[model samples]
Target: MIDTAIPHKPNPTFEGLKRNKVWLASITILILLAILSPAQARFSLAFTLDALLHTAPFLILSIAIAAWAGATGADSLIARVFTGSPLLMIGLAALAGGLSPFCSCGVIPLIAALLSMGVPLSAVMAFWLASPIMDPSMFVLTTGVLGTEFAIAKTLAAIGLGVMGGLVIYLLARGGALADPLRAGIGNGGCGASNLRTPQPVVWKFWTAPERRAKFGREAVKTTLFLAKWLVLAFLLESLMLTFVPAEVIANTLGGTGIGPIALATVVGVPAYLNGYAALPLIGGMLEQGMAPGAGLAFLVAGGVTSLPAAIAVWALVRPKVFTLYIALSLSGAFLCGLLFQTWMGS
Candidate 1:
């Protein structure tokens, strides 16, 4: 369980700068570019700014939706879907996971809470599988960067992966394969456990209350800052990639409409994925450089679920068997999604 508390320290500004590593990295990259090639640095700055400006509308809308959900307490309602029959719960959980506002890391505490409350691991697995792949914000950002078709395909993939994982886990549980899914001391408590355990009624008109309005503002600002840093870095990296990486190289590696490219992409995604939001511009750049659509989808789906932070959280929370199952399901589902999408694109 992640502690939400912030410990007081001297030199708070320095501490904040230390924590903002992404921004620091972005700055460092810019400084190096300026020193090594001022012309390239100017081009990168222009590219990043242009991309950010083009994406501003989507970014604002995404921020509003996420902030609204947080302030109105609608996120807490996700737990309600896990109470039905196993099949129904799994379906609803998958759908909910796709639509929910939670990020990969953000969903961990909720998953821990659900498991602690005796919600079926199958349902939780469904949500867990899907939550990292697509959220409302991610969908909007993806559409802005990749197109509506790609975003919709990714969302469907997320739900499909969830349902597939849920069914597999459900079948395994029936055979008494996964009797205890959680780690020894995990699931007992988590940062957001209380909210899931006893959900509060949502206030749809969040602005009607002062506190809710304040909450909305805070959430909006927090989400904006979070997204801004990643996206700025992403656009910078994308500009550099477009300038430095040869199109033929990308095409040769990830461009072919074959299982090999897609499988390779899935494997590479596990370790190479930066951040869900950060990856969009890079993927967009790859596509422009002739990367196959299927390979792109496979990479995004695999990385979204099994990124380092997300993978670590799952590993720390669940038993080795469950963790292994999660990785297996993620890889297989990503490959299958890629294959089907490739076939569809060809047709």
Candidate 2:
């Protein structure tokens, strides 16, 4: 009982009229199309749900880490810690990396902040290399999926690799072969007045510094936007890899000795941006299908350390060669850790 005789008044604006017509035409086409391909429609919905499953954990971890960094002043603390003696810095990095659940993606900003705060490059490298493999989140994930024994062994391997890598970087860094745009007193005039930007006044002027509020908001916004943008791409790619690529292919290709494990881990993981939680279920599935524990461990560590987005984030702060070294160091550390896990720990 619609009034088809009279012309219904539509939005007079050009843009509004275009929008209405587009919506109507789209709905009409969809209605006709639905009658033709119901099975395809159902498949599309299922595929979407599976993709969401693959992406959810990575998204959650990234957002949570961003929130934590904003809340805690961990960035500044890391920077201050980085300013210590090279040996002490490396040790601290190993300790901090061992404990924190933060991944490479989340750690980049913290390292940048640390650099701004004056932490040594070696220490930052140590942390970047180890945290993803040795952190509690990764530990729980490895233990739950692989086993407690595997997790413990993996942790030991991470620590050993991290320490050795830190020492190597510390020694090599003295030659100044690597470029470090983030070195102390380079940018922002040694983190003095330049970093202390425009201030916003608060209720209690005497109690709190206006500078802190301004800096906090700026950093929070910056970090959130940066992480969020990368996370979307990471999520999409992760889903694509999980859904399309056969797990067996990955396992078969990456498994075995003679640096095959390391090479495969690096090549595969450099592009696969997975957080600790996002990886566990997928890894569990792979392991059940006969993926070697050591190879799987290597994949997890490499994936976390060599995340493309995280590398880019870090490259924004440091120079290209340093970033390249970071990738090489993380990949090497992951492979060595995997080997050690396979060798030393009791079966």
Candidate 3:
């Protein structure tokens, strides 16, 4: 059995503060580290903040959506609806996941609840693959950074990837491959959520409840710290990459329109691409440096789906086989996107 307890204890560094306070201290370290480096800490801070400003609206909306859904017992109800037609459910789940504003962390609790409620694996896989890639806010940001065409292509690609993962998961289920879908602790609140089961009926006044407000505050802080840490690191790395990596080098190395570039792109993308928002300016920089259009798409698709944070969230909730399937689907979809784009767009 996987012991998924989140540790909570006091230390000298933290004194009497809680876990959230520890997170805040860690974020402060990141800022201080930024100032000491050749990364041009001030500029990186500015860049990261600008990106966060743009992302704040989407982040808030995603949280609100999840909060309301949880408060109203809508998550499991929606899951039950997907049990009838797996194929159609897959499609709709993919679209809805792509459009949903939640990040991987924001959606983790919902996933745990769905699994506990016996949601079909097919729909769950679709939602998992699509949830972290693109949302309405992500779409607008991508369009501004890359272009309208790139943005549309990315949106379509996210849905397509979700569908593909859904089908594979469905087949795996039919074959009796996995003995279980939810991991040892997932259904029992190992996903760090206590109220996964059906709770007391919450109405429009859910927001007015004192306990509900406290829960929301905790979630909000946790999410902000999670996002802020990764984004700060991502922006710092992006700054370093921009400063050291030259345009000519990027063009000559990754500019080729072939299998090699596509493979290389997806592989690097799995690790290099951090946050969807931070990836935009970095990718835009690459494009300006004559990076191949297809490669750019491949990079974005690959990284967005398989980013470390997103992958970690999945790993925590799922068994190894399903986790492997998620990565496989992401890489394959990225390669396919690269091929199609290069063939048609000639980039």
Estimate, for each residue in 184-237, the C-alpha lDDT of model 1 and write its tens digit: 888755767766777899899889999999999999999999999999999999
Cα-lDDT of candidate 1: 0.92
Q: What is the lDDT, from 0 to 100, of the residue 250 in candidate 3?
A: 90
Candidate lDDT (C-alpha), each: 0.92, 0.59, 0.73
Q: After superposition, how far is residue 56 of candidate 2 from its true place, in Å?
A: 13
Q: Across residues 123-211, which tens digit of lDDT does each residue of candidate 2 receive?
A: 77777677766765456545654578877876766666677778887888788865454734335432322212321222333226455
Report residue 185 deviation for candidate 3 (angstroms). Answer: 3.9
Candidate No. with top lDDT: 1
Q: In candidate 3, what are the lDDT values of residues 213-240, reduced to their tens digit?
A: 6666666565555556655555555655
Candidate 1, superposed: residue stretches over 4 Å from native: 1-15
Provide the lowest-lDDT 10-residue window in model 2. Answer: 192-201
lDDT of 1 at 158: 97
